[model samples]
Target: MSAAAARRGAEVVLGLCAFTHDSAAALLVDGHLVGFVEEERLNGVKHTNSYPANAIAWLLDQAGLAREDVTTVAYNFAGRHYLRPLLHVPAHLVDRLTQTRAIPRARSFVTVHHRYRARMAQVRSQFPKAYLQSVLHHRAHALYAFLSSGYDEAAVLVVDSLGEIQSTTTWHANPTLQLLHAINDPASLGYAYGAITEHLGWRRGDEEGTVMALAAIGDPARFRPLMSRAIRLTRDGFALDPALLPLRVLSSRYGRVTSAFTAATCPPRRPDAQVESVHADLAAALQERTEQVMLHLAYRARGTSGSGLLCLGGGVAMNCVAVGRILQEGYFDEVHMPPAPADSGTAIGAAAAVWSDTTGRAPGGLTQRSYLGPAYPGVILSTAPRPGLSARRLTEPARELARNLAEGQIIGLFTGPVEAGPRALGNRSILASPLTDDVVKRLNATVKFREPFRPFAPVVLADKAADYFALNQLSPYMSIAVPATTLSQTVLPAVVHANGRARVQTVTQEQHPFLAELLAAFAELTGHPVLINTSLNIKGKPIAGTPELALDCLTESGLDGLLLEGWWVTRC
Candidate 1:
């Protein structure tokens, strides 16, 4: 293993994460993953969880190696918590100048363990000292959900909204990733659904899944006794119960979500403010008490690892409606989340735990597509020259992109790679014309400008997804959530939702044969093989990673055609 490390080939590693938020970067070579990004999709900045120095220089220029041919960077999380608050100034001037709370909880646990362990040794001297390493915050989200779950043995939860001090952990991962439970920080079901998405005014850790998709438009028995007094369970996971906080707890009791997400409104609308009905019944009792504490933390990680196969991830398994009520309560026969199940796929589980501890093998596993990031390298079908744009070249490019989305238009597509988390499975994506609801209020106010109660995701055709969503399995990463049938709520009315549910994804031509031949040519010309698709980024950006930011989000969106990789354009 030497001739200069075998001419610097496999055994690379570089997982990373930034100061906090969603900052990210990942790359692995011998342990496999390759590349992953998200410093707000190359700095258009939507979730700059800070410090992904432009996703670690685009993951060392997409691994063409040269940061001294990598030495093991890992990083996941290490903003050390001696109850952080930038190591509180004399514990917030002894709690607002002697207003009690004993010397700010013993000088915030004695001067934050030597100034947050020298600020995690200056975050490992910002790496590049031959694999600097750090990796622990939910064990890099349980090694990116057990190395992206190809499950040889499962049951790996993670949960999120607080890591470097725990916020629910659980593992058994037969890739040898055992732990059983953790919980710490001021108890959390991701901050008790981010303190009910910051007491319904919104913006609590990226709008707690837009309050779990606006709690399917309200009525969880009117906040059922404040979501059963905000989390406390503990048979092996559950805790955000600061005496069931009803409100006025502004900032840090144990953790105050890294300074209130700058008002996180995702469809959290608010311009001239309105929304009520107890803010959709406290977003339907905080998405039904966060799926009754994630099905009692998935039946206590399937009864302390009896493993029916689980594989979740932190950031509360990106609540695809509590992963569609834990795949309709079939207490796991198979689950697997990964499409960057938050904390930016824990930088591919901190470089797959130093390439499975210096290579013993553990690379590829996640089947059903996940692009891995960055693509659209020209040559997509071809034609566009640009002058006043209108370059066609369709000897049936998915039948003229399904007749420009059945003539309602919208398009965008982009093509190949560029899907490293936060759903957009149709390579880059945008599409539209999922029948109507006025192309879902013109893709939510002129192309993802956001709100009209944020929603749009269909992308069907994994064998017509059980005739339009109602538990048709194999959800190629639109995470989960089902229901929507009864004829996909009147023919895919812009990817359903007001209780008739939707958030689906499917699509399989072994994951992406040109988005399954463009949803089989839009189900052979509009018999509706589903499209809406979403996530070509804009309303808070991330998805479009280039092709000139997918032609500047199709020139400030309202799209009407663009298809980069396949080289088409429109507009005149």
Candidate 2:
């Protein structure tokens, strides 16, 4: 998507991520993503979840472009126009008032106009000369998912925390995408999932995925009955009983979630901090129920729309386990999951939506690749030369890079255009042997400085993916999980999460030959084509934007070596 943006002659493209965790805006010019970063990195806060004004200014400065120079200002969501009236109603009449507020009457008219006026004012203040446009939040997700997908036509499913009022939506996309059926109501799968996240004593923005991960470790049977009663599954959608799981209950239930809220009750849990069997059971129940709901939607959409390809967006789509389950059902011929399966990717979506909608382009194409962030070369690495730089590049050296990885040496694999999405796809990644369980501890302690519970992902040779995992399809975005094959289970056990599955990135010669070659090389040495590929960042920072940043990170983290654009920076 960045490549396309850059190719389209957008000298200064500002991608805005607002009102959420790690909110940020990126700037791209002349097909080059000039400065890309998350706001959290600048704030030194984990999930520093907020709007991206600071990040936007940084990007503008980084590109030497003023706000007026920006051609367009694209926001992920329209201001919450439809909900303004509901916001003012009394607590007792909340639902009924909110329902009426949706009617778009003269009273409701204020909500829409006020929202548009306020958002436009904000945009105008930021970019007085640029055209201001608001893309529906899910549309942004769908746009990025389909545009990057490289599909001609596919079923686009968007499931996110919430976009204004929408939680889930299904779009039947042709070359030009169009909305089909959307679960725009606030009582959505994402909200239901969020409600569970609150119940589990987790932070809303930062801890939901953890709950998803924890879900796999527990049994769903014990709590299914209770959960089923709490969550009523409708034919086309699902509803949550506000009585048991109020949206605001989290603020009251957990100390971490305290904030402004109304009357809401939270069911108490056992006192154990360690993930108890009950916690696991509840997580499993949520996972199971959510997966079922998603599958139901997918099958229905596919059957009704007569489309075999599926493109999934939204935060909920980040559940690789759920994605894998969907794939195993064999309802869709192919599925594409954008790497940044969250709101952050909405920047790409916003841009793509503008391009496609304006140009009336078609859909159903797979994304070119991720390599969307900023880039740096001589500026960073040339300043220093360390040891381990003696190895020369060869014409067909896939076997060699693979050999080096198997030799217990950390290799910084910086290949072509850096990936646009969150997951590093060989272009801007730190590669290591997933077989080494100790590597996880070492990398996290020294390089990542993140929670150990967050599992590492793998980028494997596409052809070899089936041999190693339960699936044979290409998952370039690292969004789906497949059980490890016996060979992979033994060869790369550490990368496999406790659930015996891996969030896999399948590399092909077409998609990334150099990476595939490196994998092949590693396979030659280690007898495995898999390498632990993680975003190249150092604790609470955006992935390296320049060669200098990479070198600095490499040196500080005790990495074995750094393979850059053309130069190799090794440890001293």
- Point to the candidate with the largest TM-score: 2
> How much lDDT does each candidate structure score?
0.71, 0.68
Tens-digit lDDT track for model 2 on 505-539?
Answer: 88888878788777777777667788899877776
TM-score for each of the candidates: 0.35, 0.80
Q: In model 1, what are the clashing residue pairs, if there are any?
A: 21-49, 22-49, 71-131, 72-131, 187-239, 187-240, 188-240, 203-264, 380-565, 380-566
The C-alpha RMSD of each candidate to the native structure, in angstroms, is: 20.2, 5.9
Q: Backbone clash tally for model 1?
A: 10
Q: Report the C-alpha lDDT of model 1 over 1-572, residue by residue, as the tens digit.
A: 23255246656777877666778887776666667878777778777766677666766666565666666777775544545533434543444422343345545544545654664566566653564767677888887777775767788988886775577888897768889877756466776677657656666777677777778878889657655755556656665543343221223674332222223222343534787776777678678878888888888888898888888888878888777888788898768788888888887887777777776666663433378777756554334445455666556677778877787888878777688788788878888777754888877888888758877778788877888787746878888877887888876767888877787888787778887887788777768778878788777677777776777787787787777766678776
lDDT of model 1 at position 251: 35
